[model samples]
Target: MKNKILIWGGSLLAFLLVVIVVLFIFRSRVLQYTIERVITKVENKYPADLNIGNAEFVDWNSVVLNDISFVPHGLDTLFTTDSVYATVSFRSIFKGRIVFKRLEVSDGYLTARKNGDVNNFDFLFKKSETAQPVDTTKGRNYGTLLNRVIETAFDNVPDQVDFKNLNASYKSPNRMIDVRMPFLRIDDGYVESQVSILADSIQNNLRVRGTIDPGDYNINASLYAFDEKGIRLPYVKKKFEGEVAFDTLHLSLTNKRYRNEKLTVRGRAMVNNLILNHAKLNDEDILVKESAIDYVVTLGQNLFEVDSATEVRVNSAKANIYAAYQNKPSKIYDLGVKTEWMPANDFFGSLPAGLFENLDGIKASGELKYKMKFHVNMDSLDYLVFNSDLDASKDFKIQQWGNTNLQKINGSFVHTVYEYGKPVRTFTVGPSNAFYAPINQISRHLRNAILTAEDAGYYSHKGFHEEAFRQAIIKNLEEGEFARGGSTISMQLVKNVFLSRKKTVARKVEEAIIVWMIENLDLVSKNRMFEVYLNIIEWGPDVYGAKDASRFYFGKEPSELNLNEAIFLTSIIPSPKRYRSSFDSYGNLRSHKGYYYRLIGGIMRRRGLITQEEFENLYPNVKLYGRARDLIVTAPDAAEEDTTEFELETIDLLDF
Candidate 1:
């Protein structure tokens, strides 16, 4: 029995050794056949030519490939490599998977260029061309989708990489970017890459290094300028029309967890010496010294949330932020931010330079804190909730003003009235300026009329009304357009007196900040702000202020307007340039304006701004006696004039 066992074992060993020897002798041919099969399959699907000059197995686990290239049909070369050497796992091949343990490339070039709308990379996304549009109404699990993508990406990346003399480029329209990488490597999950970039003829270099994890969500990376000029982004300027630069940017993803159909991700991102320049953001370049955010996000079945534990820091100020959006059943949103009470000096110093241009260099005393919350249900627009409050301690005070002096509205100053975003007139708000109307000199009917129509709570509230802003948001959402503004009497005053009239996000922000300062700090009194607002705003094409508007329409002074005349003047505030739409060929007010008169007059009467007899006697038979009378257009037919009235009623009556 012993002899039989020994003979059988020797026979099995001899057979296995012979099989190994045969495979080694034909390894090059086997590798070549495998490469050919892969090339044929890829070419069949992509409509491209894939070629390899030579392929062979240098060792049991290593493959050497030379002169590899790929090109789409009738297009420039997409990729080319002089040589590639990869160490692959042989056992994974038996399981129908090719895993590369190490990969090295020599002299590689990849190009992605776009001319107009046509691009060479479209072929790589060929499958997407034939794909159907997504049905957004359908239910989806956000966690499941994101997890699958992360798993697929992490599973495929090689553990080690060594690439030298690699070049890549992209061009679109008049813009182009060229990247030259001298060295790129990954070893034991550590990555290092130094790349020189030329974008739109501007040159820069960048350095990147990080500790990465493939099987887990663990990464810490730092990216910054290779030289002393800081890191300027390559593709952002053209894409966003904004120049962005930073000294250093770091990101760390420390943890990921899943439970109860929710995937939680914890991470932190940091930046130093960040600069942003854009028209919509600000007219000047905004600079921040340091900023960071430690965030925890929960991606759920159909919702995404950044938990309240998330902390954000900018310079010396810090805040806790929470935001969420739910798409299931109906779209709902929520956002909140709460900040710690910090020194007012630090708060003012932390303001971004260009974003808060009016507040820059402002000096203050005491402590300040801020809190805000917003909630909305798209399906129920009326139920939207919002509140924002920025409070200072009792000892808080502004010691010095910044670039803009908030107290200027209290007295005479150069007020520029803009027409179509160009300065049509620059004059003083006091008696020295032509057609300037003081609060007391303006007609009581006109004052009451403008205030009641533009902002009913202009006297009782601060510079901003939370309810008004909330309703503004709801109204805009219902109309699916920006058709309303929540500007108060004070906001309107600040916008006209201290800020440019250009419609931009940055201007709006500056206007808001200035309004708060003047109104809350009593830098400008309510009556004075209202006086300046009435004097500087445009009431018609080239007709500005209450004094000019009255003269232009009725050939009368500011104090001579009656109730009907004031109401008529107020109604045109929405489309002042199109004010002729409300008049007939004879310069008589449109008939539908009677409804507007009754609506505004009744409100004034109820609020005790006018008597009941004044409200009851109100009429829309306003007549023009000035140059505006000759500007009215002749009606094609008197019987069809009601169509014009109907069309005119579609506009929302406003004064600011």
Candidate 2:
């Protein structure tokens, strides 16, 4: 009986060993069929083609896929990977969940292309409109849909994900971007991505490691972006290239829809070795060795708030800046900038290159201290304010101006006009000085008419007409051109004698500096300044100055000019080069002259320069008897320019 039992047990053991061997031999084929069925079920919804070279289970907790490629149903291949390994939790699987402990992807390639608003990867899922307004009445439906999504996604998500050696390329019509990532890891709500990017002529390395809680719509991220080669910026359609390095940038975002329907952002950023160069500005370098900023932002539907404090070190000079912007009920921006005592050259050197090209030989001697406060509102400029204080210890000398120097310069004035002698020589070598006149030699009617028509606040204000300047700026902003200029007499004189005719912000700034110097230094008395202005002012094609203008228009002396004649002269000062358009083909004044005569005459009478009887008698009935003789008053120190006879001098309103 014992022998028979031993033989039966041996037979049973042999049968069990054969069953285990057969299962081991077919394990790969079982895994393959199982994955193929899973992919087929996924394709029912997402519609994607999945290719897999091999799949195998390592023990019961881990699975590995080799040579996997994913292609959208009717599209080209989107991604390819050498291997993907996933470790699943057995307990979760028993509970109808496919929870993963770790999932790693290696040696992957991804290609994405965008054409207009549609992109290549868009084929993976059903398409929908990009933007759609939310209806609160249907908010419960969204919750239902979200719950359904979570039930489905809970079985497919991995708790931890990792990728290595990924190459991605994205292309569009205007630009192409390429990215290479050596490592990317994500666990729970935490994510870390590091990439080296090269686009056009720019190359940079970026790392963003952060936690994103989608359930609460919150983000806390730290950024590290650096580039050895500078990036190009076109802020105002002007290209400026700058090298950028940010050692630390911590950002936190919070959503408060329950309280205010707003998103709040807080951040601290630090930068080093930032140098900028502009080609239009003659390739001058603006260097900022270091900068540190603390900023906060709050954004809503139609309103936003920004507050920032920055410390900047530029061109070896240090400055502290505080800026705030609010757009709730009304838009407002306020900025306060202060700088310690620094060399004047350092300040000037920091400006755009070629702005002071006309004064290359000039040297400024002194330390400069500056403080500025700026505020502006979008609705109206009634609240617009800009106050600045700049002081220098010594004078600035310029060799090319022959004897022009700036001493005890202060910050004041809205606009200035000047001819830089080289490109625009109308004030230097033209017939502008052919008939000079002193303030006493000129008639009071002409002076008062000019002051009334051009600058009513000429004597009251130091050198700026704040209200007029504000209006001029408003008009320009609305008209989108340099259409109006509320220049004071002193401002116009400085522009005529000292600056160029270019319509640029840089030129305007230089003109203001010169006007401030001229006013503060008392270099020229107000009366003499007006005299020089009248002499250099262009009257007609070849007519200039009060003497020649009186002779050219009425064949009279500056003192002998009548009320009507003086009114006519002052009316054309705004556009002297185009004043001939004011006359008809018969040499008689047009209907517009009647309007000007009434306006100028009324103002003149109000200022006591003309009596009521004279104002009433003044009419636009001036007769052009003959043309003025050809006369050129060239300054001995000025270079002569060859110009035509009928080429009127371009004398525009000194725009700021």
| Among all candidates shown, the one with the greatest TM-score | 1
Model 2's alpha-carbon lDDT is: 0.63
Model 2 stretches with alpha carbons more than 4 Å out: 1-80, 84-106, 110-112, 120-165, 173-175, 180-229, 233-259, 268-293, 308-404, 407-436, 477-482, 494-498, 513-525, 540-560, 625-656
Worst 10 residues of 1 by lDDT: 644-653
Error of 1 at 253 (Å): 1.7
Task: Please report, in order, the local distance difference test score of every candidate based on alpha carbons.
Answer: 0.80, 0.63
RMSD of each: 7.6, 10.8
TM-score between model 2 and native: 0.61
Query: For residues 1-656, what per-residue lDDT tens digits would candidate 2 score against the true structure?
Result: 99999999999999877865655565555556667776787666566777888877787667898998888766667889999998866554434434557889999999888879867676543323453544544222322233334334344444588989989988889777788999988789798998787666456677879886656555677767655443332222323343323344566554323224444544455555444444433224534555445455555444445543345554456677766666545777778888888876666555433445544344555677878777788777666776766666656432233124433112111223333424332433222344556668898888888988888877666676667776776677568778998678877776665555645555566666677656654655666667667777778775567887888877788998877678888988878777667765545567767766766666666666777677656677565544622122223442233221221122222321
Please report the TM-score between candidate 1 and the true structure. Answer: 0.76
